[model samples]
Target: MKKSYRIKANKEFQHVFKHGKSFANRQLVLYYIKKPEQTHFRIGLSVGKKIGNAVTRNRIKRYLREAFHELEAGVEPGYDIVIIARQPTKRMNYHEMKKSLIHLLSKEKLLSKK
Candidate 1:
């Protein structure tokens, strides 16, 4: 992920958690809030221990990050996005995960019309 697109600050995360609207599909939960900046969009991924071991958590995070990279070009500018992985993600392969992520983003109208 590029530095400009990364969600780096604690304040940003907290703002999203507190104010962003959320939607969930089978594999992931997405939270989004509009921000004033137009330069770039920021994204954060959360994978919890309740889902699995460290390996599984890391694997899920990696999958999510890759999926985000693929879809990043379609994302609208000036938003904060947070994706939280669910237990179902442990059983999903990369393609399935990617599809789910895209589906969720599309549902949220975050993805630009294509």
Candidate 2:
């Protein structure tokens, strides 16, 4: 995703965690807060240390980012979204991860309906 569309502040992520609504499947969690003043969505990815070492965590993050990038256009434009990878995420390939992401976001009603 573009840097402009990424949520970079730890404070923002924390706020989202505290105030945003969340939905999840077996592999991914979606947290979102409506930010009507903002013109576009901002996304954050969180893959924990327990998932693996640096390389594995980074790889998981990359897959999450790619899924978000593909889904961004179909998502509503005024929210702060955080995608958190669960433990099962370590075993998933890109397509599985993407499918899990879409499932989580669909529950949140962010993505356009199929």
Candidate 3:
């Protein structure tokens, strides 16, 4: 994911958490708000230090990002999405992470029907 498309600032993250609607499942919490333009979706990832050390946190974030990228085509355009990692994510492998992410997005109605 590119920095320009990521929600990085504290203010942005707070805004999304405060204003955006949320959906969740066993592995993740997704907060989303519709944006004006229908060009592309902006994504933000949150993997806390509480999950583990820097290495583990980075690994989780990377797996999440890869999962998101694979599912990007299914996501609706003109939305800001924040994916917050949950404790269960630490125990999950990459394939499990991908499946959980896709399932959550489907439940949130963010994924397009194939």
- lDDT value, candidate 3, whole model: 0.87
Overall lDDT per candidate, in order of appearance: 0.89, 0.88, 0.87
Give the per-residue lDDT digits (tens) of candidate 1, residues 47-84. Answer: 88999999999999899888878887898888989998
Q: lDDT of candidate 1 vs native?
A: 0.89
For every candidate in turn, the CA RMSD to the true structure comes to: 1.2, 1.1, 1.2
* Residue 41 in model 2: lDDT: 91
**Candidate 3, run of 10 with poorest lDDT:** 1-10
Show where candidate 2 strays beyond 4 Å: none
Task: Please give the RMSD of candidate 3 to the true structure.
Answer: 1.2
**What lDDT tens digits, residue by residue, belong to model 2 across residues 1-108?**
778899899999999999999888888888999999999999999988888999999999988888877877888889999988889999999999988877777777
Please write out the lDDT profile of model 3 over residues 1-114, one tens digit for every residue: 766668888898888899999999988999999887748888999998788888888999999899878887888888889999998889899999999888888888889996
